[model samples]
Target: MNWIHSSKRFFNNFQREILAFIHRKNLGKLSPLYDDSKWEPGHWYAEHYQRHFAPLRLKKLKILEIGVGGYDDPKAGGRSLRMWKKYFRNSLIYGIDLVKKKALEENRIKIFQGSQTDESFLRDVLAETGGLDIIIEDGSSSNEAHIKTFKTLFPALNEGGIYAAENIHHSYWPSLSGERWSSLAKGSIFLENWIGCGGSLDLNDPKTLMNMYKRLVDGLNYQDFLRPGYSPSYFDKHIVSIHFYPNLVILYKGNNDKPSNFIENNALRPFVLEKLGVESLEELGLEFSLDNSTPECTHLELSKR
Candidate 1:
């Protein structure tokens, strides 16, 4: 068939579903999809997924992404919706968006029309789906939407499943700058209540997130933290960034009592790789370190609720 004609992201088995998701989001927000010309991986969603999705495997995974059915984003392109259907066949896929019936494959893809701020709706979905293996928040770019999802759905993810939100640039949207920690900011509104492992966001004060926001803003700098020239866009607007790039970030869902410490600056950032006698960012072109590998990481951990 035309499988060979597909993009390089597509292989004999894997089809790059996230790329498809990106393109579709781009379409709903921006323009129309013509010839799958909207997205380019190295550019859009690269920093996030490069290390974000490599949780080791995608086979037989269950995935969900909020805020679907939009125009192409400056980063993700069109045909992204359909592309997801192609790549992640082994997995059961579900999506939610402001508008209904617009997600790429409605027949094969389970979709819901809703808002992330709707806790009842979110909890209901999770109840039915059990727990998602990978949950993406590319849905409504609203601050409240983000906060709501963080407060609610993230708790429903499997122990090792990932919960991510994209286009957090809106958190730092210039128009929203002064209003950052205001009642309107999503993280400010919701994340405040999550308890930390040493700090989880679950049992937080709700108002405390603003304080974290202050710390996040303080850390927002293109600092020369590591030995290599790697820096992740964090693709986030709230903080200057998460960790350096060429490496991905892994934030643990520590415990209901305390939040995960990975949210803070990397203690490893200051140690020069040269002095430590390493090559690249850890001598590997990876986004994280040995301690920060899959199941065990110093920066992230859920002690238990």
Candidate 2:
């Protein structure tokens, strides 16, 4: 866009062949949601990945992508990590994987080879990147890796920063799922994975009396932040909350508490917000394409807390 307005569009389109390859390998692993037309994450949750991260205008910040594999391979979606550099100009985008490969090497993409379970390796990366504004863990598809990384980095998260773990459904898979420890982390509070404690907000069941209190956890109260009607951020008054069908979501962590639902605010401290980066996404505008004509992939419950 710096050169010409014409440059604005998805820079890549060779995703179809890569999609075909992933499907053949998974062999209908996505049959549950695939309607003989669209594809699911196969080995990787593709649509959900875009839903969760692609939209945010992360400029002038540091982003760490753990387990970023071959973007050309179906799992990595034959994509380029340099796009992250595009999204964040003053940003230092780093990618770490078990093995260092080609897709791992892209514009401004710092590569690190190590296990997420290794504390020294993680610290070394964080130390090199200086600090992170966002951390996306899409590695090995292991729950242990997710948990271990979270324990190590969540506290390191820059105030109102974002820490995202893709394919979290692995947390439920018996073997790789590991064990559900406590709600405590090294520095951050472990939020019950959206499905955790008090998460069963079934429409069939009546709203609990306690959740209707005046002082919501994160803010003054639901009524205080209301503009008049619209249900006030829908029970849980998160900044940008979207629960797309089965599993996909995009939520901001404000100063709230653990297991906070509709009324309860889990934001214990203030959020960081983004800095004035050289590459501000403000020009990018809002990227969530909700147009009806654009078919949205239904979210699948891959992992639950």
Candidate 3:
């Protein structure tokens, strides 16, 4: 039994080593474009990036990618940084890793060593980069780490820029947090709550990033519920759109300051008048009156008030 167990362990280790070697070797050949060609063995982010970033490729943008692996081996990581540098020829690429990766530094590609959850470190990096046009959160999968990184960096995205969080499926697994249903890391829960899924929320929990998003969404529509003593949300005028994918969430930043307007028509007024026994248009406070003088000449016109 001991020999059998040892053999199994050895086989697993060997397989891991072989796969790592192949990945390292193929990393150099993959291109963000050219979907028909064979892709290097890695996360299938190239196609998504190609679609979203095609417009900004030629712009001189500042991009930050969190989590450069290969922990202690400084010479081993920064594969994504290199890929970004090649893809965005005119852009500067910045990468952050928990371990020191000074060896990966090169022209147009800078590597910073720090934790994704460290707000101060993240701020310093932002200062060094002079603000960011794009941010990709590919760091630790812990719920706290994801939330911290997002809260710290998302606000820093430039107007008309994007923030993408990848590998978000970790939120649904117990190994990353707790139970799938109760876990705060679940991306689905965040999206649901943001879209106004009715439920009570624990606002104090660190895993409650969804609550933040929900509040922002409410802020966007605050004009509808404006009343006495109402406080405004900071993101109410900043967030343009929130997009969700299988294991990803991308946020676009833009001016969302336009107020929503409601255009009421007479299509539904007839139903109310016929079914509820309404006497006159004044009961409904409707400015438009329905005219049925003739079937061919019937029309609804606004009243001069």
Candidate 4:
């Protein structure tokens, strides 16, 4: 058994070295997705990131990626950091891993030793880097760590920046579901249901981060609802958009301070009332009458008849 493990390690290291050599030679000429020879292994995100990061390619940017690989091997991590350095060119890449990867630090890439779940450690990293333009959470797939990291670092993202969490399918697996506490449940699961049902969950239970997010998603169309005592969420005011992809969630942070308002266009009211077999707007609790003077008056008159 010991010999088998040793042989496996030897072959893996040999392959890694060969790939690293090929990657170093090609460097900026090839896309990270196309070049499997590169040490970084996120072929799935390459195309997506290329499209999203096109604008920031040449610009000086700060990026933080949680979870450097190599696990127990101190010398084996920082593949993604190196990839980012090559791909972004001018961008500074910062990576944090649970294990020490200080040996992997180079000109534009820095590796910090820390756990993604530690709020204070994350804050320290942010302090050292000042502000971040991109935050990628690829750390421990444990739901608690994912939730804690997002809650801690998302607000710190620069306005108009992006926060992306990968490998979110772990929410469904029993090992990573964080079943011990509801708040620690996979965010992807929460988001799936929240978006599908349009915030039908209880809002009072702050223990579940999903509930909080549900409220924020609700805030997008808050004016349409009748929750009298509910206050607006910071995310509601700042999150420009939430995008969900397979095993991924991207949050776009921006100025979303615009108040949610209803347009007074009643163009569809006549058709809707006719379909419902309703006579007066009073049935719908609306004061305004759909008379002939209304824009859809012909339809309204026809419906009344």
- The prediction achieving the highest lDDT against the true structure is 4
Name every residue pair that clashes in candidate 4.
none
Per-residue lDDT over 1-305 for candidate 2, one digit per residue giving the tens place of the 0 to 100 score: 56554344223223433453354223233222222211344333444544555445445677787755442242342133444554355677777766555444656767777877777777676666664667766655444445456546644555456755555344333331224533332222123222232311332221221121112232324332212222333223332322222322223445432332322222221221123332433333534322211111111122111
Best by TM-score: 4
RMSD of each: 15.3, 18.7, 15.3, 13.9
Q: Please state the error at residue 174 of candidate 4 in Å.
A: 1.1
**Comparing 2 and 3 by TM-score, which wins?**
3
Candidate 3 has a TM-score of: 0.61
lDDT of 4 at 141: 53
- Candidate 3 vs candidate 4: the lDDT winner is 4
**Superposition error at 31 for model 1 (Å):** 16
Model 3 spans with C-alpha error above 4 angstroms: 1-43, 175-229, 262-305
lDDT of 4 by residue, 1-305 (tens): 99999999899867755665565334433344234222245326655665577778778988999877666678986777777776677889999887788998999999889877776776677768876889988777555566667767777778789988776555544332234444544444333332222221344434333433434565455333333334444565567777666666777888866543432132224555577688544566644432221010000001110
lDDT to native, each model: 0.44, 0.43, 0.61, 0.62
Report the poorest 10 consecutive residues by lDDT, candidate 4.
294-303
Assess every candidate by TM-score. 0.46, 0.44, 0.61, 0.63
Q: What CA RMSD would candidate 2 show?
A: 18.7
